[model samples]
Target: MSAPSTPPAADAARRPARGRPPRLDQARTVEAALVLLDESGLDALTMRRLADAVGVQAGALYRHFATKGDLLTAMAERMLADCSTPPPDPDWSGRLTALARRLRTALLAHRDGARVYAGTHSTGAGTLGFAETLIGVLGEAGFGPQEAARTALTVVHYTVGHTLEEQAALQPGDQGPADPERLREAVADAGLPHLTAALPVLTGTDFTAQFEFGLGLLLRGLRGLRRDGSGPGA
Candidate 1:
């Protein structure tokens, strides 16, 4: 007998069969966390909940992420992964606009995504790469280093700010525009002729149009600065 022939069942138990289901990993962990976030906002995404979602013990999450903040930073970076991709458009302004649009779309894709992103200053691969792209475009477009950095920050801040407000407005509560008649009455009572005349446009907000319009204004200013050689210290 060959040492009483080790039981096949025992051998199989000692070594998981080839192609055994994959263990939980960082990518899968992030995916699970993101799904929870999309389905039920940020507040509901505790580590325990994430572990359960991924079919692991809560302590297992610590192997991938040291803290909740670490996870949130990872989540923000994941959302920004596409921004690192090179733009097809050659025009600097067009590239910047495209990046901004992509960021907005990513934020809007998840519930409270903007809030999650805005809450962190993550220096992850995706975040740094996106910054590099934005600043690199500005540098090639005749912006000094300082001006280029400022312009990049301006674009990012504007996108984050707008999306933050947009997401906030989506939450359930007294998101009151009130009655149309009441709004008209208030505007009429204000007695500012210019504002009164423009009340309809002001009261009816189109966020997409507003974002593009604001971005256009920023780009136009950068263009003017470049043409006049008045960028930064110049």
Candidate 2:
């Protein structure tokens, strides 16, 4: 009897079936999640949907990521991976400015990318490396450890918040800024002179210019701190 006939069930267990799904790993799972995020926005990137995209069951995703938050953190890390390279500017301020711009560009690479990044406190290599670069630059500019940390946080908050608004305004079906004429009329009717006067620039969609302007303001303040020796380094 053919060596008692090895059990068919045991043979099947030893080798994967022809059409079985590929093994799911953290990297592949995060990649699939990002694709889903780009195609359908953050609100639509659920684990079930991601699992489907990766040819696996939702439970299988948990084997790689314990929770949806874990997956999102990984996605956030991937978004910042390219930003690890330091800029080549000779001046510290110039380097900081370039780094900030690089950060904005990275966040804008994928749909709802800023939102995804804003939600997670990723301690991954990419995130830590970016933070280290920023702090190192500030240190070279005369900021003490505490001051450098706070300054870094402030700059990051500004960049992320600005990009968040920028992305939200550009979302499909979003009404975007109110029409200039309509906004002026409403502000005039409300007797808000200052708001009426600022409407031209206020309602403008020049995110790049606005970002640069805001960044300049922060840099100017930092310059003041360094000049006056008011920061902790002093």
Candidate 3:
């Protein structure tokens, strides 16, 4: 009798697993990637690394995500979940403020989370829907589409940028002037009278306070622009 023929590689590729749970889908893979990201940071994440974390062949991931960019995009969408809650009734400004706070809190929760966010455009359905809701609220509040869109983007940019800087602020480092004495010495050497005068005000204020202060400035400026048309010949 002829020896039993072995299954060809091509044939095996077409066959399904008999009893094991179905292989992970894109969402599961994405979540696994995010878990790895939280633990290992964005720089250390690789397809091989993710598959190993998820207990699957690296090749199995390709069945879900075709490329790293695809995986990154998926991760970015999950980031928006923190910020994309439904609007609270009759309180648009409150709604917007709450949204920004939520986004900031969520981004701060992970290691280099904002970096993942910054890498992706993050204009997926969930984000766009949130954007639409924001735009509609702003429009009803007397802003045009152009103004609303720009304002929405500004809020998002400020939120992400502030959160990134906050993360850096908290990371262990000697980047800040090491002490009050060092700060005084630097200020005295520079002889910038303004810096010396403001040192006390600036010294103790942490990132949370700075964020609200900066947000107020942007929001105030936007309001001023709307009211007085802060432009030439307006």
Candidate 4:
């Protein structure tokens, strides 16, 4: 007979420990990417940098995302996740204004956030849900599907464009005029008659006030469209 076999427990103990690392998924990768993104802008968010931040090898990132573009899209999806919440306002214009404010807040939360948001297609639940809400509001306001979609997109695009300029100006080394007198003098020296006349209000930039003012203008224009029979079902 062969020598007595080792006991089952002893045999199990003799096997080598599994050395593989824990697997990471898309959400975890996006979480790590966002942290890195908030500290450093989009350009610094390379796969190697993200992998290191997440405690994985660079190649492992490809398992969750095929390319950097795919990763950026995921980032954008997370950005809009908070926008999926239901609006508190009953009026269509109020709902649109609230939505615009929420989107602006989201874009301003991260470094270079607008750049990350720009040109990205997010098929994520949050993005779709927010779109559905906006369209629904427009529907309640007597807009057809096409006009409703256009209205929603117009608001979103305006928010994005405004926030892009806001974020860019906030970046390092791009501060606007600190001396009001100098700015006024420069404007006067330029001999821009109309611009000079408007310098008092134009030179002092209050982004919040300016955004709301412009939003009101757009909403007024939309209301005019509906009143004039230029809107859907007109």
Candidate 5:
């Protein structure tokens, strides 16, 4: 009893719809958000924009990120993911120097990367692991837990603050503070003797040298404190 076979076109028409593609997961969403950040800066990285970039509705993002802050924290975590381990150095100062430089490099990689990391407090694996390594280095160098923790925080703050200024001054189309000649002229006009004296080095575009100089100052202070046996728990 072979009934007439249904028409091929009719059979195809009866198939259920495949529907839209699956929504992006949290990691992919963060990745896309980072791309958007690099392209348009943080102000343009709205959730709606990110959703569009991911080919999903804005509400779909809520499934992964509770809020924009949450997404930002995730992005911050991603930025530090590669910095979990400290560089190999014989001494704590050297290790800290390398770690600080690595962090600056990471923050300078994307547009407003330091801004992305500044406010968010991410307890993610990357952030925590980096902190653990820094603290561990300090501890191994004869610093007690309190001193190690405080020293680690001081290093992080200095690195982030320096990178923030560096990124802002170097941003494209930003001619305000980055103009060495203009700054020098202003200092001279203001009759600021000390500033004028230091203008050459201060206005130089040698951020690496400036950063190293500041780091050396901090390490020297720490060493002095250790030597004086005045540091906490010493």
Candidate 6:
């Protein structure tokens, strides 16, 4: 019998899928990261966790993404992937409300939920897409470029802020409501009388009610801007 013949390099190259698994792209890696994020909060989303979630080694992730920050940027984008540039509309109030709901839904779906969305990561399409939608909606509301930009920023800022607060206040099936005094004393007695008196009407309610109230106030403020150039419009 001939001595064991070694396979040629070309033959070795033709090795079947039994050797190593296919490589994951940035998106796939990030998708796995998101899944890990949903299952465990951000604090728990180490490379090992993501790798385990994707059925790969931690080192494998570095092939597609450089570091955790890069992974996070991708994950953030994935969270808001469904949202995109807004279209012009006559019923901007409804449009705004819809945007708010969509945003709330997107943020609430993940673990650590809003904690994952605290700040900007400019490299992500998710952030850009959300910004584009808000700007377009505000522009359609009779706002000029600058006005629309600021208004969109404020709207999103408020949404993120409120969403974070809402997420922090409750857990799965916990009836624990927000401490109303937290919202009450937050308003100054002298300079912020309106906010003070409106405290019970505002913070005393459930998150759903509070969300609607704040959104209504935000929209009402825009109405004043629509009528006069006073709101960022000026």
Q: Which candidate is the best by lDDT?
A: 5
Off by over 4 Å in 5: 1-19
Whole-model lDDT for model 5 versus the true structure? 0.86
The alpha-carbon RMSD values of the candidates against the true structure, listed in the order shown, are: 9.6, 9.4, 9.7, 11.1, 10.0, 10.4
CA displacement after TM-score superposition, residue 161 of candidate 6 (Å):
1.3
Candidate 6 lDDT over residue span 1-54, tens digit each: 879989664334323235676566666666666666765568888988777556
What is the C-alpha lDDT profile of model 3 across 72-134, one tens digit per residue? 877878877645666675765666777677778878877777777775765677667667777
- Least well predicted 10-residue stretch by lDDT in candidate 4: 9-18
> lDDT of model 6 at residue 45?
88
- What does the lDDT read for residue 117 in candidate 2? 90
> Model 5 over residues 1-234: C-alpha lDDT tens digits?
989877554334323236876546788778888888987898889999888777778998898899999999999999999997867889889998888998898899989999999989999999999999999989988999988999999999999999888888877787634587888888888999999888777767778888999999999999999899898448
Assess the local accuracy of residue 98 in candidate 5 as a C-alpha lDDT between 0 and 100: 89
Q: Rank candidates by lDDT, best first.
A: 5, 2, 4, 1, 3, 6
How high is the lDDT of residue 113 in model 5?
A: 94
Give the local distance difference test score of model 6. 0.72
Clashes of 6: 0
In every candidate, how many clashes are there? 0, 0, 0, 0, 0, 0
lDDT of model 1 at residue 187?
73
CA shift of 52, model 5, Å:
0.6
lDDT of 1 by residue, 1-234 (tens): 557756554233323235653486897678777888877789988999887766667897898899998999899989998777867898988988998998899998888999889878789899999899888877877778988888888999999999987777666662423345677787788777887787665665467887888999988988887778767536
> TM per model?
0.81, 0.89, 0.77, 0.85, 0.88, 0.73
Itemize residue pairs with steric clashes in candidate 2: none
Supply the TM-score for candidate 5: 0.88
What are the per-residue Cα lDDT tens digits for candidate 2 across 145-221?
Answer: 99999989998999999999999988997655556677877898899988977887888888899999999999998
**What's the candidate order when arranged by decreasing TM-score?**
2, 5, 4, 1, 3, 6
Off by over 4 Å in 1: 1-22, 172-185, 189-194
Q: What is the C-alpha lDDT of each candidate?
A: 0.80, 0.85, 0.72, 0.82, 0.86, 0.72
- Residue 200 error for model 4, in Å? 3.7
